[model samples]
Target: MSFCNPIPIRLKEARKKAKLSQKALGVRIGVDESSASPRMNQYEKGKHTPDIGTLKALADELSVPLSYFFCEDDISAELAVNLNKLSLSDKQKVLEITARLIDESKKG
Candidate 1:
């Protein structure tokens, strides 16, 4: 079965979260200023897909993890973004907390 590509949705969300216009984000990610707006517009509209290198550039520029673009669910995607904001210690704490939650849920 073909799952709908989530990039477009998540890209738009990330772009908006960064308060960037399509042209601005495109330019920041190294697309030429002349074609930036149209190119980013196409990606957000799902008419075109950016390659992995471009996506990596985008994730870096947008301050999100590259893996966030490919998450299968919104909750996981949002969690990835939030987790990216944590320090290493905080992330380990989150991991411990989540594992405890999972174990508790399994026991019930």
Candidate 2:
């Protein structure tokens, strides 16, 4: 019901879409798997909030942009639709080219 609630809901949605349990996601982000479940539960229930670093780590682990959590619009659905518009082969080619360009840019 509050603005803060959307962040956890979006995180839960992203984690589920990625087929990751809280423990698995926590592990990916270097948190203890044992504690992750309850922590995520708190997050979802809005009993606790994650700091910026944890949110960033969660976004990275979920392979989503941090903006995915903050955007008031349905950016994830839009991204999904855009990705669906791309052919699988074209997607791979684009990723490869983009990676090379990023690497070159980093070197410059």
Candidate 3:
């Protein structure tokens, strides 16, 4: 069996996490419903890569930042999700906390 590419793996995981079937995600992103299933299947199989516009649409429809797709690790992806859920004030607080943690790590 062919090893899955990271993009395809991430796409499938995010789609499932959002509780969308491939056809559902395709239609939500404005693909014609008739072709949605095959189109999304192609994407998830790494047979096709969506252009940036389509990628942005997918990200928006899935309620995730586009950066989530490019993250190299699950931790980074999870961090992106958590950070995206924060309000501006809360984001700043998170940054401050992260900075403090980094400083503490350096000291210890």
Candidate 4:
């Protein structure tokens, strides 16, 4: 069976949650801001597929795991909503706590 890539959908959702314009995301990923708009539009419309490098760049720019682009269902939507609800300070706090938890787990 063939599988479809979910990167386009997840990219759009992540970009929105991050409150970034396509141009902004593109620039962050090393693409020209002007080109980023159309490219991102194509991605969201499922008309273009980004390569692994672009996917990694997008994931990094959006502060999400690369695996996030391949989530199989509406879980991405839930994550987007939850992440969007956080203030920058709250998000930083969560990241700090998560890092500490990971370190603690590793020690145990």
* Alpha carbon lDDT of each predicted model: 0.95, 0.77, 0.90, 0.83
Q: Which runs of model 1 end up more than 4 angstroms from their true locations?
A: none
Residues 1-108, model 3: lDDT tens digits: 755456777788899999999999999999999999999999999899989899899989998888888887899988998899999999999999999999999999
Runs in model 2 lying further than 4 Å from the true structure: 1-4, 75-108
* Model 2 lDDT, full chain set: 0.77
Q: Best-fitting candidate, measured by TM-score? A: 1
**Order of all candidates by TM-score, from best down to worst?**
1, 3, 4, 2
The residue pairs that clash in candidate 4, if any, are none
Prediction 3 TM-score vs. true: 0.86
Off by over 4 Å in 4: 1-4, 76-108
Alpha-carbon TM-score of each model against the true structure: 0.90, 0.64, 0.86, 0.65
In candidate 4, what are the lDDT values of residues 10-78, reduced to their tens digit? Answer: 888889989999888888889887697888888888898899899888988888877778876777556
In candidate 2, what are the lDDT values of residues 1-108, reduced to their tens digit? 755457777788888989988778877888787897888878766788889899989977777767666655576545643554678998898789979999999999
Inter-residue clash pairs, candidate 1:
none
Error of 4 at 91 (Å): 19
TM-score of 2: 0.64
Model 4 RMSD in angstroms:
7.3
**Alpha carbon lDDT at 86, candidate 2:** 78
* Colliding pairs, model 3: none
